[model samples]
Target: MKKICIALDYNPNSEKIAAIGHAYARALRAETILVHVISEAAFYAMEYEPFMGYDSPFHLNNLDMVKELEQGAENFLLAASLHLGTDGIKTQVLEGETSDAILSFCRENRVDLLVIGTHSHSVLENVLMGNTAVKIVRHTGIPLLVVPTKMEG
Candidate 1:
């Protein structure tokens, strides 16, 4: 594999996924690219429910939240790449549907492999993220390394 794309989400499980993906890239001597896809800001707005007598999360309009979300995504990727301890690692913060953005990046970059995790952190994440692994599997033409990040019951 000449190029490997590691798909990551905001969930903590992504650390595991990123490490394993980095290992595979090292083993194959491939270029590593850390990719984080984010949906619209409105998607994240749901997480900020009115609390402590606060009016609402809706007060932060889409424009404000979008900028924050994009920045967060960039920082997340930067942290992940640093944690991987690879200076050559490239980070990308993609905007749009999760699976679609990932697949498009892989295709555009000619990625030979894709690494992703199967588990998410919360009900909100599951709802917002959906079954991204399944969607990517069904759609991607490149090889996939699916890490089992699902917690045991």
Candidate 2:
């Protein structure tokens, strides 16, 4: 594989995924790219409607908020890189729907393999809220290395 992409989120279990993904990348002698996609809901968590002369409590404007979000995501990828203790790994911070962003990036970058973390979800929960890993699996043709990040009961 020439390039391997690892998708990371804010979930704590992402650390495990990163570790295993990096090890695999090293073994394959492939270039690694760590990607973090910031969903719009994550950036705009508050719902507010302004009435006559009403102002939103959020101090930063939308543009500033987006900048902050991007910076935070960059820091996250950097921390993951540091934790992996590796050099020459590329990092990308994308904006949009999580799974779509990841898949598009992989396709555009011609990533040979995608590494992702999967959370344990009950059948009902899976139906109610579709999982990103599931969505990727259904849509992408790239090879995947899904790390199970289920917490112990």
Candidate 3:
């Protein structure tokens, strides 16, 4: 395998996922890419819009917020790469639906292996929000390695 890609989120558990992914990449002598996606809703929320006859107060016209987020993602990925002592680690910050962005990136980049973490969500939340991991698993042909959070002993 030449390329391994890991999808990262804002969750702190993502660090653990990155660590495991890095170890596997090293074992396979493959390069790693850390990918992050900014959801469309988040970007749109920065602007003011009336909803239910009331305007949202959290409005800001600056698009620099998105840029900041991208920068943050880069830094986060850099930190993870350093933790692994792995060289040539690439990072990408995309804008779109999370699962779609990840799947599209893996396919377009011809990634040999994909690594992701399954969040621990309540049944109600999972049912309402749907699972990004599950969506990716169903739609992608790329080999996936899903790293789950370590269970308490």
CA lDDT of each prediction against the hidden true structure: 0.86, 0.90, 0.84
lDDT preference between candidates 1 and 2, better one: 2
> CA shift at 98, candidate 2, in angstroms?
0.8
The candidate, 1 or 3, that scores higher on TM-score is 3
lDDT per residue as tens, model 2, 46-135: 546775887765543756676788899999999999889888999999888889999999999999999999998898998998889999
Per-candidate clashes come to 0, 0, 0
User: By summed lDDT, which 10 consecutive residues of candidate 2 come out lowest?
Assistant: 40-49
Which is the winner by lDDT between candidate 1 and candidate 3?
Answer: 1
RMSD of each: 4.6, 3.0, 2.4
TM values, all candidates: 0.80, 0.88, 0.86
Q: How much is 88 displaced in model 2, in angstroms?
A: 0.4
Candidate 2 residues lying further than 4 Å off, grouped into runs, are: 41-48, 51-60
Candidate 1 Cα outliers beyond 4 Å, as residue runs: 41-62, 120-130
**Model 1 Cα lDDT, one tens digit per residue, 1-153:** 899999998888898899999999999999999999887555655555567988665556756777888898899899999898878999998878889989999999999999999874576876786688878888888899999887879
Superposition error at 48 for model 2 (Å): 6.6
For residues 1-153, write the lDDT of model 3, one tens digit per residue. 999998988888898899888888989999999888878636544665678888654466445665666678778777777876767899888779989989999989999999999987777987999989889989989899999874557
